[model samples]
Target chain A: MKSDIILAGVGGQGILSIATALGEAALADNLLIKQAETHGMSQRGGAVYSHMRISDRPISSDLIPGGAADLILSVEPMESLRYLPYLSETGYLVTNITPFVNIPNYPDIEKVMEEIRKLPRFIAIDADAIAKEVGSSRASNMVMLGAASPFIDIEFSKIEAGIRTIFGRKGEEVVNLNLEALRRGRQFAEENR
Target chain B: MQKHLFLGVEAIGQGAIDGGMSGVYSYPGTPSTEITEFIQENPLAEERNIHRTWTANEKTALETALGMSYAGKRAMSCMKHVGLNVAADVFVNAAMTGVNGGLIVTVADDPSMHSSQNEQDSRFYGKFAMVPVLEPSSQQEAYDMARDGFALSEQTKVPVMLRITTRLAHSRAGVARKEVLPENQLSLPADPRQFILLPAIARRKYKGLLESQNLFLKLSEESIYNRYEEGAEKSLGIIACGIAYNYLMEHYPNGTCPYPVVKISQYPLPENYINRLDQECDEILVLEEGAPMVEEMLKGFFAKGTPIKGRLDGTLPRDGELNPDLIAKALGKQMFSGYAIPEVVANRPPALCMGCGHQDAYVAMNEVLADYSKGRVFSDIGCYTLGALPPYETIFSCVDMGASITMAKGAADAGLIPAVAMIGDSTFAHSGITGLLDAVNEKSSITVVISDNESISMTGGQDSSAFGKIESICIGLGVDPAHIHTIVPLKKNHEEMVRLFREEFAYNGVSVIIPRRECIQRASSRKRNKK
Candidate 1:
């Protein structure tokens, strides 16, 4: 009845879009949802996060308490590790393997992957490569959502519908590319599992 | 019956619309920016011909809303906590003048200094002005408070302060909308001189304001927003205000807290509920988003009454925002198994965009300023503030909106030759022009770089009030035309920009440099929209 998710990534990386897709999916299921997003200065290519709490009952807090998040779905690998404290012991973490190398001192990629791999319940995928293969590089976030989709409580079909609903304005071609990206990501997660 | 998923800011806009607001005025600032943006974008608002426009500054926005209210139309003015300081003169005086139509002055406070200069609470402002402050716990309450805030304003004939912090303002939830109320018809105040606070008349009005406190308190006690809920335990009474109530409620998911609780949204501090909680409980913890206003008041100078716990007593953090984890810690609940953050993650402080004009301008300034002492460059708010970080840490101080120009003037007067101030176009329009005038009059040896991005790029590209008028405004303010130089911030123009900077730095009197370029984000978005 309740799913507390932490969406993490660098700003302008479509993390909010992922939150919105999941939120719309939750709404489609008649679930109450509260998504607390970072706005203002943080949006200018800074490390950002959004706390999403969905429930059958009225959600009390906009934030997910530390160590209570059921899922930490991130679009960037380093950003994923940034919120490890919020992840429940039994929670799942699905993060894109690619590093958003904005900072001069970004950690070694292998080390970042090593830290993520240490977690029991985690899936690290090359979302960027998969998204490019799916015919749109911008759908990397969709690939991330697809990878996190199974761990999330919402139905895959519902999430797909949510994507279509969100991307419908951009034209059918864009929608299809994102759909393909999502399916590939879901397939990768399923195969690995 | 209609429910729409809305951010807390959007909910306020929706509530204002449903509450029959005729005008919504504001100057764009973080957290508070989206409220006016939402109203401007609403189709219903357009149909109603609502007066929704970005003002020159928060003061103008407040005054414009007051003017609309004077015409007997419900009006709302919104701004961030700092913006309230800009509009404080009008806000304090408006309390004395009272209202003809309803007026709601909504302010969004950013705790933890997120996108703000300071985290000063606006509840203090409401308390100082002796006006009722309404803080909503949820998006629903945010909607309801904004909808009903008008009636509260009209009934009391005083502007209501609908105060919300950044979390509530930016947080998203489903808001169930109410039936639309009709806007008030145009009518004047009963007394012609009601707004005129002449010395003799001001004393009478001040007395009326002071006397109105009892009525405000009575209303607060009677308000549904302020509730005293009985519970089985008396070990620890909880006093949660606004969004803090939501954090408290998170602990007791079944809609019940074990301790006696006072959920405060409407303030004058419903004394009846406080008295009951004081009598019933052993210890009381006050959980408010901002300052420990109520906690301090209850635990006075003598430190009398129940052991009050909150920010002051290390029960919660004295600074920054309140979170569920902090709330749980206060309640002696289970703690999170704190995972050590990897040292690998470098701090990703916000920076100028890759193609941002500010980047090029900063690059040029840094190169030019190498000949001079560092820390002489003063900056103001906007995306340009990012220049304080990496590659080009050129700016020394960014105190407030207009402090840069004036501070540069002061430093120049103190013999910091060729003192420089870097401000954005919107910020220049906000408060920099006056300082520029003062520099002109004093003939201060300062170089003012008005980085014209042609938009208020910091708060998500709201229309810049100084869009195309920065040059004219500078000239009109008495700066010599020849001294006002313009340059495009680009790689090819880097040499020219540096040359201009060097020339201005050597100028004896006031010299204005405008680095002109549309914000890349705005430019791209505008292009996409056109396509």
Candidate 2:
């Protein structure tokens, strides 16, 4: 009845969009949700993460305790490994294979992937490529969310409806493309499993 | 009523709207920006014609809100913790002057210095000003306290402070709504000389404030926000304040704690419950965000009789922030050691955008200053403050708002010739004017680079107060017209920009070089919206 997720990415990468979609789904399911987000200077290009907790009962802390996160859903590979200290032993790390190369000392992508693969449970996807294939490269965050969807406590239908609600202003074409991207991401995760 | 998700800032804004706020005044700052933004965007607020607009700075915002309150209307002024320092002059005096209608001065503290220069607790300001401070532990309370805070102010004839930390301000949760109230009609203070702080009147008002301390304590004692919950164990009593209360609860999931607890959201320490906990329990653990204000009061200078623990005693780390894991460790519970992150994940500090004028401006400044030794550039708070970061670490000082020019002037006075001051346009408008005026009065030999990005940029591109007026502002401040130069900060104009800096540096008097360009983020977004 409870899910704790750490949504990670570079600032302005639209990780908040994925968090909002899940929040909307949690609301539809009548679950108590608390999401702690980073704002201001960090959004200029720093590494950022949102600690999201959803439960059938009231949640206490806005922050999830370290090692209690059931999922580390990251849109960037290196950013995903940054939050390993918060991931539970059985937690699933769903991250994009792409690297957000804003920092000068960003390590080799292969080593980054190797560290991620060391985790007992993880799903790495080229969410950017899948998003482009589904139309709209910006929807990669949605694809990252979809890859983590199976582990989320909320139903997939609720997430779909949530996306419709969130992207309603962007027009039907954008929403349809995002839904298709979500499906493709979910399919990839399912096939890999 | 249907429940809706809202960030703590948005919830406070919504609550203020429903609570009959006549005006909400602010200058945008991180975590605190969205409060005024929410009100400005709300249909209800617009329909009510509430005075919601970006102010020149936090001081102006506080004064404007006070003016609204003087006319007997409910008003709220908001700013980040450091912004409170900017408005401290009026803020302290307002407590002595008291109120005519209702006023809520909300200050959002940034622990961990998320987007600020320090992690100062605003509660200290409340204590210094001797006003009641309401610290909400939850988003719902963030709404409720803001809604009820106005009434508390009206009843006490003093402004009330609703303090929130970055986590609570930026976090999202479900907040219930209240019925809308009507704004107060125009009514001046009962006393004709209530607000007049002449030497004789100031003494009387200060005395009144000192006497009112008892009533303030009484209000805290009876406040619904402060509670005493009894537990079977008396070995360790916990006093959890503000958001720290939630972190304590995270450890005890069954809605019960083994230790007796006092949950404090209202200030003045709720002495009665503290006494009860002290009498019943052998020791006390004081859990509070920011500085160990409560813990210090309880511990006192002598180290006291009963053992009290917190930041000072290292029960909690003296700095940064508190999370649930730290709370668990404090309770002697076995802590979880999650997997360590590999060194591959390097630190990704915040930087100026790719096309940001600040970046190009720094590039040109760096090139121009290559001949001179480093540690000559002083900068203020803004995106340009990032010039202190790598690839273009050009700035030498990142102090308070507007300190750049004044500090540079001081350095020039100390024989550091060709001194440079870097500041953003919004920051220049905020407090940079007076400093520039000071430099001009003395004709100090310092070069001031007003990096005009045409937006606040730091706190998400709020409209700059001196958008198109920077040149005139400098002229009016007595800078020579010939010495005030403007350059477009782009790669194509790098040489021109460098030449401008060189000219200003050699001027032997107060000079300004305004590197003007619209913020790339706002520019691109505007283009997208136009399409």
Candidate 3:
């Protein structure tokens, strides 16, 4: 029952928050979760990622093997391609269309997106556009997460409940916005899928 | 409890909360930054009235935590391994000036130079300081030991160090929650003479430290961490540590590992375990990260170790880190060669992100220094130092934090004047101030380029110490207002910035050119959010 899920993205992208939400959702669904986060150079436009593993059974390991992830939640398209190796054979890939291509040597967006589309399982979404229309682009990651929720082992309400308390601790305003983000993402997924 | 999940960093912070910490003081450094960030963000911290704030750098962090400890409170200071070097002065001495309160210094070591100039072992600092060190095997242990670390310090009359490698620092495990305890009420030191570290007082304190060895050895024997795991009847005996212990078990997943292993995660190395291992197997592999300190010590204690294999024998790479395959080879097991990562063309590695102020600072330094027949730029530790690598290559020296200014002073005094001292905003506050004071008093003609990125960019965008004060610090240090010029470090303003650098290069006294700009990477993410 010891399995692994690796989530990676740049900082300021709410990648860590999305991972937190996922971890919470898994826990709420009655799973044992162990997530490790490593982000430095994240301040320096460096890539940030976390290794999350949830098991219905007791687990001993924290890290996942290459290509072992059951789901790849890509906040941005390039990140999806970058983390393609971690995807299991039957894994689902939920990605947004925004490109944060800061690295000069990296291939163009079209090339990277083309590479991601070539992968076995990928679901690309304009999560950023959805977030933009909602006037809060920071929720782009949550949008992608909501779009991917039905595919994960856990139900969406558990994720919503997790998000409620998480943002509830801050204020009622953030809770409302985050809930709206979830709804918009779910709606996007229902319509598109 | 609804089975709350946690990030490894947040878990450490949560562990601290569960372990009962009074306060956390730190300067953000990668890998270790989240420990403090989590504390600041967690609602429990606010509800429980916990304290969390970013200090100037590691020195201030150590000193502030020491101040809290002085008040008889449980305090922790965290930073990357390199930050230990900055805190070394106070850190080494804190052992002699034992505390009424408990102090735990957490250092996250970077292996393979991830966001660090070098991968220095923090355990070496523990040895140098003669302080007790604890390494946790998993996230749960990270919490347990973190709590124990404080009491252990109190028991030994010295501060304790929690040394973790990148793997352990970044890895997570199911950490069962321990009962949270109440915070230790702030109390004062009993004896006023306890902290008077003058030579007159230090001699006895040093003697006191030596006298405490018995206590250290006692803890080493009974530490909950050090374990003698029984292995299958066969091949060899292995002495594993931290993540290495995890891998040892992983390699022998079927529980048929053909070796008797003594996995240790605590300091001073239990003598009983060593004697038992000595009687047990044909060969011994001292598996550890960072240094061969254990191998060197084991050789001194146990005779020849039945042909011990590690860094000394070159069975493993003397430098860098050890992984499962490397451990397998050391155990003479078949190695799993990884998938071939194709090499790319010899292009310059990433220097600074576009619109980054550090880049403009470098560009200005290079442009102005080209005017001089001889140009020497002494660089300190920060994101700005990345200029030493790529298209910019402006800085020459990168030793420790604040090393740039002092190193520049030395070179300037020895006929290398107009020496450019390039340093970061956070670094200037950390160690740069003392060097700046040195430069001013000595009248060292060094042109100091304070690359004010408004955040500690290299260490993952923690608040920069100079967020409010940099000009006044220089002004108070006797740099004239005329000499202290500022410029916004965008690409379009490079020409004007170069003009400023040229002017500073000609100044007779210590001149500061503050190229002020928010870190592009930092601004991009947080700018949208209302603080």
Top DockQ model: 2
TM-score of each: 0.99, 0.99, 0.85
What is the lDDT of every predicted structure here? 0.92, 0.92, 0.76
* lDDT of model 1, residue A125: 92
Per-residue CA lDDT of model 3 for A22-53, tens digit only, reads 77777767787766665555434556667677
Clashing pairs in 2: none
Candidate 1 on B1-531: residue-level lDDT in tens?
657899999999999999999999999999899999999999999999999989999999999999999999999999999999999999999999999899999999999988998999999999999999999999999999999999999999999999999999989999999999999999998999899999999999999999999999999999999999989999889999999999999989899888999999999999999999989998999999999898888997887778899999998999999999999999999876646678877789888888999999999999989998788999998888888887888998988889999999999999999899999999999999899989999999999999999998989888988888888999899999999999899999999999999998999999999999999999998998899
lDDT of 2 by residue, B1-531 (tens): 688699999999998998899999898887799999999999999999998989999999998888888889999999999999999999999998998889999999998998989999999999999999999999999999888899999988899999999999999999889888887888887798998999899999999999988999999999999999989999999999999999999988898998999999998779999999999999999999999999888886777678998888887899999999888888988867678989878999999888888888898888889989889999999988888878898998998999999999999999999899999999999999999999999999999999998998888778988989999999998999999989888899999988888777888999999889999998988898799
Choose 2 or 3, whichever is better by lDDT: 2
Which ten contiguous residues of candidate 3 chain B have the minimum total lDDT? B339-348
Off-target runs (Cα >4 Å) in candidate 2 are none
Off-target runs (Cα >4 Å) in candidate 1 are none
Clashes of each: 0, 0, 0
- How good is the docking of model 1, by CAPRI class? high
Better of 1 and 3 by lDDT: 1
Screening candidate 3 with a backbone cut-off below 3 angstroms (N, C-alpha, C), the clashing residue pairs are none
Taking the tens digit of each residue's C-alpha lDDT, what string does model 3 give over B1-531? Answer: 333344456567887776678889888876788789888987877888877978877888899899888998888899889888878899999999988788899988887776678898888898788888888767777877776677888888788888787766676555666777778887899998888899989999999998887778778878889978777763568888776776666566565466777778888777888788878777678888788888887674546446676788788888887765566677667533422222221122335776777776777688888877644999987777778775777778899888999999999999887887888888898889888999899888998888888887765677876777999999998877888988898888878887888877988888998988888867876965655
lDDT of 3 at B266: 80
